[model samples]
Target: MAPWLIAAILTQGALALGLLWYLGTIRIPMVMRGEVRIDDIALERKGWPKREWQASNAFDNQFQLPVLFYVGAGLALYFGPTSLEVALAWLFVVTRYAHAFVHITDNHVIRRFAAYFAGLLLLCLFWLDLAVRLVLSL
Candidate 1:
């Protein structure tokens, strides 16, 4: 795997770990203290406080777009990636971090959408780069 790719992947993993820590340490304790109903969370987290809900939602967001990221990373590892792909991957990670920050902090819809859209564009470019490379090679 490219070193830049590895660094980007590790950075994303660290973000996930941070979110998991928030969920486990803060959010779960809220349930233990009867601040929120376990049943509510089990159903759809309808009763969760805004802060807790935002944290949970941010955590969930990781698995969504990042799934494609992992797939693209794996393909890049297998097929070898160029600087363009690596740069796009890093940019995508940056957007994800920005999105999570906006989501968990202020819950700003416009900022979050901007970050998400930028990341989506970067991911599309990364995939297109890979596809073009594969086609050219064959």
Candidate 2:
């Protein structure tokens, strides 16, 4: 993989790590203080505070569309990534960060959706670029 592509992937990984840290910071204390129950949370995350829930949901979101990002990245690495692919990768990372911000902070559905959609579009473009490259090479 190119250094730039690795950097983009690392940045996305950092975002996920940061969200995990944030969730733990919020949730561990709540459990310690009896603010929430482990059993309750274990069963579909019931009784979690709104803030914790949002953070958790944002963390969970990382595994969804970003899975595609990882797969696309692997393909890009194998096929040799173009500058456009690198740019799209970085842009998708930015959009995911934006989506997480809106989801955990204000919890605004429209804003979150816009960010998510933007990331999705970027991911699609990245895959499309890879597909075209592969077809052309063949």
The candidate that wins on TM-score is 2
Model 2 lDDT at residue 121 = 95
Worst 10 residues of 2 by lDDT: 37-46
Per-model TM against the reference:
0.92, 0.96
- Which regions of candidate 2 deviate over 4 angstroms? none
Q: Which regions of candidate 1 deviate over 4 angstroms?
A: none
Model 2 TM: 0.96
Candidate 1 lDDT by residue in tens digits, 1-138: 398898998898888888978878767788889988888778676888888878888999999999899899878978877788788889999999999999889988999999999999999998888888789889
Report the lDDT tens digits of candidate 2 across residue range 1-138.
389998999999999999999999999999999988888888687689789889999999999999999999999999888899999999999999999999889999999999999999999999999889989999
For residue 61, give model 2's deviation from the true position in Å: 0.5
lDDT of each: 0.88, 0.94
What clash pairs does model 2 have? none
